[model samples]
Each structure stands twice: as C-alpha cells, then as structure tokens.
Target: MSKRAVILAAGVGQRLQLAADAPAPKCLLRFDGRTLLERHLRLLRAVGVEDVVIVVGYEHQQIADELDRLDWTPRPTLILNPQYRQGSVVSVAAAESALCAGGDVLLMDADVLYDVRMLAALVADDSADRLLLDAGFEAGDEPVKLCLRDGRPVELRKKVADGLRYDHVGESVGFFRFTQASATRLAQIVRQYAQTQRGGEPHEEAVRDLLLESPERFACADVTGLPWLEIDFPVDVIRAREVVLPQLHPLL
Candidate 1:
C-alpha cells in the first residue's frame, strides 16, 4: 500500500531576509552538506514515498534551477503556485491540483524537520484524518497550537483553552494523512480561504477551521520526544544544525 505526499514549500521566509548574504530559500539552505529540501526528499524516499509533489514559489525558478543542477534522480513533480504570494493555502491548492491521480495525501510544510521514526509513525497510522502532535510544551511557545478533545483536535490556533492540553512547538511536524473526505475538505478549505484574499495570514488558521468544523474525523498521532524543528529565522538554522543535522547524518 503506497501513499502520496505533498510538501508546501512556496512561502517566503521573511525572517531570513534579516540576513543579506544568505540568498537561498530556507529549503535550499544546507546542513551537513545537504540542502533542507534534499534532506526532506531523501527521508521521504527512504520511507517508501515516491510520488512527491513540491509546491514552489518565492524564487521558484531558483528552486527549479537548483533541482536541475543537482539533477536529483527519481524526481518528483514540481508545481508552481502563482498565488504563493497570497498565502500558503494557495500553495496547498496548487499541490492538490498536481496530484494527477487520487489517493491519500500526506500534507507537510517544507520548513519543518522531523525524525524518520516520527514520519514512519504517522504514515503507519491507519486513521482517516490524523495529526502528529507534540503534546509537550508551555503555553504560547508552539507556533502552531492544536486544541484537542478526546485525543483529537477540536480547535486549532486558539491561544488560550481551558480544557485543552497545549504544548506549543515551533511547527506541526506531523503529516496529515487524508482520507477521501479529508482530501476534499482540505482542498475546499484552501479554495475558500484563497478566495477571501487575506494575504499573508497563516495557513494554520484555515486548517484549524477545518479541524473544528469536523472534529470527529480527526485523530491524534501524538509524536512526543521526536527530533523536530521549524526553520524560520537564523536561530532556527542554528537549531537545525545542532539538533536535526546530527540525528539525520546516518540516514544521509
């Protein structure tokens, strides 16, 4: 049983702009002599995911050129989201369109790094709509907060919750394994928000809305104590180098 995966990599990392010399997108940034995108692709390949789609924007041509330069074998399809400047939801939409055929879609962010076991765990779960959770954090720390009830997310991105156990992590390091209903709903959510024309709002807002609207369909694949990091600012680069790179060396 094979699965399809899509990486939403089209966002412009405004934080990296603080540094003038580093012209590469965060995905193109290298750690231990391998680019972040390369690392992600390698991990996916190792785990038996061959049908990958990368949504490219914010110097998309640079990403394409880099891919050409490296000539990564068994290359996955690349789709350009013209509305990438609009928001990540648009990128998600683009990836959704590039599916070519229908199957479960594993949605992920390109800026996040996670352990192979965590990826395996999420992929292994036979749930309809699953989320990889990092239920270990103080309030207001995790950049993307998930509010859950009965071991599944009930609300998303809400800062304060009385009955919810929220441990804020830098990013959502888990994969969204979609069923047919989930895939349709996820695509519809993207289309809805994309039409609203709210530029630069976080994609997680739309995702939270989706989860809240239909909480019963979502399941929690709690991935605590896994090595994960979100690459946003220069500090994240340091953290990725210190933490993710070391753990990933054997795989690379």
Candidate 2:
C-alpha cells in the first residue's frame, strides 16, 4: 500500500500565461472556488494518502501560505527545489528522502484537474509500479504516453520511435505508484540528472529510463472517459473549468 505521495509543484509555468487573474504558481488556480492544490490535497487525503511532500519553487512562499490556510490534517512536508527552472526532474529528485524512505510513494504533478476516481484507481491498485492512463486524450506530441504491449508498459514518452508496436497506448495521467525498491532506484536516477547537464530534461526521462530498463516492473490502469486535464496552456485552463470540473464528483 502506498501511504505517501510526492507532488511536483515547482516549475515557473512560463507557458501558461494568464491575464490579471493569473495563479502565480499555477497550483493555486481555482476551479469553481477550490484551488488545484486544495483539490489535490483533499482527494489524496480522502483516498488515505495522508503523508504528502510537495516540492516548491517559483513563488514558493505563496504555496506555503496556501498550505497554512488549508491546514490539512497530517501536515504535508514542503521541499524547495532550488533548480526548479532547470527541469521537472529536479523537482522530483528534490524529494529524494520522501521517495526513498517510504515503503511506497505516489508521484504526482500538481497542475492537473481530475476527478476523485482518478486518485481512487491508483490507491486501490497494488502493483509495485503503476501508471494511470487515459485513452481519450487528444492525439499529439504534447501528452506523455504510456505504450503497452500485452498490457505491460514498455515505453513512456511523448513520441514513440519508428518501428515500435503496441497494442494499447494512452495518455499518462502524470500520477504514478512506485514501490519502495523502485522508488529508491528512481530517486537515484534523477538525483544524478539533478547534478549534471541533463538536469534540463523533463522528469519523464527518469521514469522512462526505469520503465524501459525493467518493463516487467510496470503495469497501468486505464481511466479513459474520466474527466481530467493537465492545466498547462491557457486553453487547458478553460477546458478544465468548462469540461473537467463539471464532470467531477463534488467535494465532500
């Protein structure tokens, strides 16, 4: 059972330029009143993942203040990613202690607007290394895909190479479950990147490295038809509020 989670919320969000009503850190973006951060904490808490570690940078204090405002039970730990501007992987690697010490950890992206069922599916799965997938995402080079052959994740990338054959492919929910051993290994992989020129690469690189190295270590559950969207570009923010939010089960 994964009892803890590491949320990467450190990026500058340069692409998601909003008007005057902009959310400085992006995690504070609200849907119908509750922020994405609030929603993430609430849903994770509801699913029994009480111990959370959030990596903060780029308006980190605002996030800290938001945490104080929420005062969520079993307080979440906040880690500062000094090089948040460099790459997403640094944010993940910044929480190395949380990822490596825990028995199993759920790794997540904080900018996502999703239904509670999305969290529910991952918590219920006992797989050592698990990925949440959605077959309904719009096709493009944007979404990180989980390519499966015979139901096992063989590749995790934005674009699959020329001759790869996969029976199933879906957009990664950017939420994952990693067992203790795998989590420790993943931490090692990214920590090295955090110290090198490769630190600029997205966090997905480390995840894919592990996935391709040990394809048998990963399994995925499809959450297609579930309303969810990663709040990246301004257009996505509109989609989240108009499309994804209305479909979510109301906050309890």
Candidate 3:
C-alpha cells in the first residue's frame, strides 16, 4: 500500500481562540513543547508515510514558516485552500490531485493529537477504505457520530436525531484511510459536491455521500482505548495536555 497523508489545517479555529485566547492557527498551538502539526508529521513519518500534503489557508504563511524551520527528510507539500473560510471540505477538495496520485491515502484533521499506535493499527488493517472509530464515544453535536451495525458503520452524521436508536455507535476520530481507487472516487465526489453544494458542510458529508453510493466499500476500524484528542476548545487542550499526552508518551 502507498503511504501518503493529507492533513486539513485550514480552519481559523475560532472556538479555540474564544476559549483559550489562542493567537495562531490551532495546529500551531504548542503543547508538551511541540506543535500539533509537528507531532502529526513526526507520527506520520514514523509510520512509514513517505509523501504528505497539508492543506493550509488560515495563517498559511505561519505554517509554511514552521515547515521551513523543520528538517523533514521528505518535506511535505502544502496546498492553499482559497475557500478555507467557507469549510473544511474545501481543503480536502484542494488536495484532490495529490490524493489521487498515491496508492493509499491517509486523511487527517490537523487539530487531532493521537498516539502513533492508533494509526499503526489502522495501517496494519487490510481494508481498502477505513474510518477510525472511538467506541468510548462522547455524545455531542460537535463530533461526527457513527452508527454501527454488525461491526460496520451504517450511518455517519454530526447530529443524529434519535441518538438512542443505534445499539452500537461510536465517535469518528477524524482520521481515515482510502485505497487508491477510493481516493480517486473521493476526489471526484468532492469536486462534484463543491460545484453543487454550498460551503460550510463538513468534509465527512462528502465521505457519507461516497458511502451511500456503495456502502460496502468502506469499513470501520475500532480504535477504542487509544489515546487521542481533538483540540477544538480550550478545555480540550487542557485534557490533551493532562490526559492524552501522558498516555501517548509511552507509545512515542
């Protein structure tokens, strides 16, 4: 399988600023003496990902400058999403070419901080397309919710109307793996969606549309008990520092 990664880092991270008075992009926020983007790149390299594409918009230069300072073996390619102010899906759309060029692609949200083992497990899986699921899910409107049936995700929505209906539901870890064919399909779908749909829709909506076309094409990788944190609010950063970071240290 081809090891490639595309990280969406274009968001303005308004919530984090409102909560923590963050002055820079959320991915640039420092924790445990390292930036979130830096840690993600390191983890990807450690897992044998040879090529990477990072979509940048909000404070793009800062991110670029940070990259310039880092001595990466195979430097990442940075793509600017002009419509970043609109939504995250635009960022994914911007990297369509790079994603389709690779054999298998790893999609990630730059705000996420996770243990390398979680990603390692997903890489080890034989599935052509997979989405990481946290079984120890926290119910909320912010996180994308997954409804699983027979160990596979049947539905994915940010806000499920009747949350109690599904016997097995999990929280999406904002990480995914797509086979080469699936990656090409995703790029086509994203392009079509961008032309027809308005902005502000999460990128997951596009993936959901792809799944609707062929539900059996995608599978879920249960990554429960793995240490990971998505830094959306100030409180999350605190938890990442106090909880997630400690758990990931041993694995690192």
Candidate 4:
C-alpha cells in the first residue's frame, strides 16, 4: 500500500501577521533557517511518506513559487482551495481526490513545528484512524480539545468550557492518520457537511462528528513528550524557537 500525506496550508494566518511587517502565509514563515513548510515536507519524507498533496489558497502563488525553487524528490501536488477564507474544512474537502488514492493518508496543519518522532509514532501505530494528542497541553478557548476514554477519543471540541468538564482530556495537535477506508468516508462526510452548512465549519469538528457517530473507528496516541508547537500567534513562534526547537535536537 502507498503512503500519502495532505498538508492544509491555505489560511491567511491573520494572527501571526500582527508580529511581522510583511508576513507570508503561515506555512512559509521561517523558523531557524528553514520554512515551516520545508520542515513539514522533509519530516514527512523522512517518515517514508511517498506522496504529498498540499492545499493552497491564501497567497497561493507565493507557495507555488517556493515549491518551484525546491529540488526535493517526490514533488508535492498542489490543490487549490478557492474557499480558504470560509473554513479549514474546505481545504480538506478540496484534497478529497488525493485522499482517496488508496493509501494511509496523513493530514496535518501547516503552521505546526514538530519533531519527526511524532510522525514516526503516528505512522508506526496500526490503527485504522488515529489522532495525535498532547496530554501536557495548556488550555485555551481556541485549541481543539479531546476527551479520551481508555486511550481512545470519546469527544473532541474547541470550546474551553466544554472541555474543562473532562478529567481525561488532551489537546489536539492538528495531526491525523487515516486509513484509506476512513479517508474515503471522511471525504464523503465533508462533502455532505459542505452541502448542509454553507461554510465556516472546522475540519476538526467534522472529524469529531465522525468519531461520535462511530466511536469504534478512532484511537488516540499520547505524544506528550515529543517537542511540537502550533504557531498561531507571535508568542507561539517564540515558543517554537526557544522551547520546541531546542528539544527537537538532531531532527532540526
């Protein structure tokens, strides 16, 4: 079976822009000497992911130009999500064709910086559907939260109040691994969701809905110690550089 990955990088990252005079797309932002997108691609490649499909919309041409300059093997296939401003789920929906291409599909946000071990752990797990969970997570209203029951996710939501009630909750790391069957089903679910709700539904909510509808389909892997940072704000970038990067060691 082939292994494929999808990177959702179409957002404008309005929050990060507050810190920079002329900000690029979040994926294109530099950390240390390499761009976040570069690190993600290299890490994916290192973990034996054969093909990559990147969804681009906000500043699509800039991302394209960067890809054009790279000489990396197994070149990424770019899919355009014209409705990027609507919701992140649109980008995942845009890559449905690629996701259904008969393989384990790895889906991740582009704004995160993570050690390769996180990917390795996800890939190593044989679950049909799995999500990376950070047990040592800091609570915030915006971060997606997961409630786990016996190592499997029972609930996932973004509201802080909803998650605060659970004792066994973990924060979602915006990384997922789906078997081909689950990927196909997810594509169908997103399509149906798009038809009913115009836009603005987060992709994580769709996944949460899927898990709730079929609790037997998903599991969670605790990746608490693995260094990773989701770069949403300027402070997150500093944390990624000062805290997460140093721990990553030889991976960077």
Top candidate, metric lDDT? 2
Pairs clashing in candidate 4? none
lDDT of each: 0.71, 0.88, 0.82, 0.83
Off by over 4 Å in 4: 18-21, 160-167
What does candidate 3 score on TM? 0.93
- Across 85-163, the per-residue lDDT of candidate 3 in tens digits comes to 9877778889988878968888899998889987786687656688888889777777788887666567878877654
lDDT of 4: 0.83
In candidate 2, which residue ranges exceed 4 Å CA deviation? Answer: 19-23
Clashing pairs in 1: 142-168, 142-169
lDDT of 1 by residue, 17-94 (tens): 645664556688877787778778888887788788888877787788877876877786888887776767777766
- Of models 1 and 3, which has the larger lDDT? 3
Tell me each candidate's TM-score: 0.87, 0.96, 0.93, 0.93
Worst 10 residues of 1 by lDDT: 166-175
Residue 73 in model 4: shift from native, Å?
A: 1.7
Each prediction's RMSD over C-alphas, in Å, is 2.8, 1.3, 2.1, 2.0
Model 2 pairs whose backbones collide = none
Best by TM-score: 2
The CA lDDT at 195 in model 1 is: 74
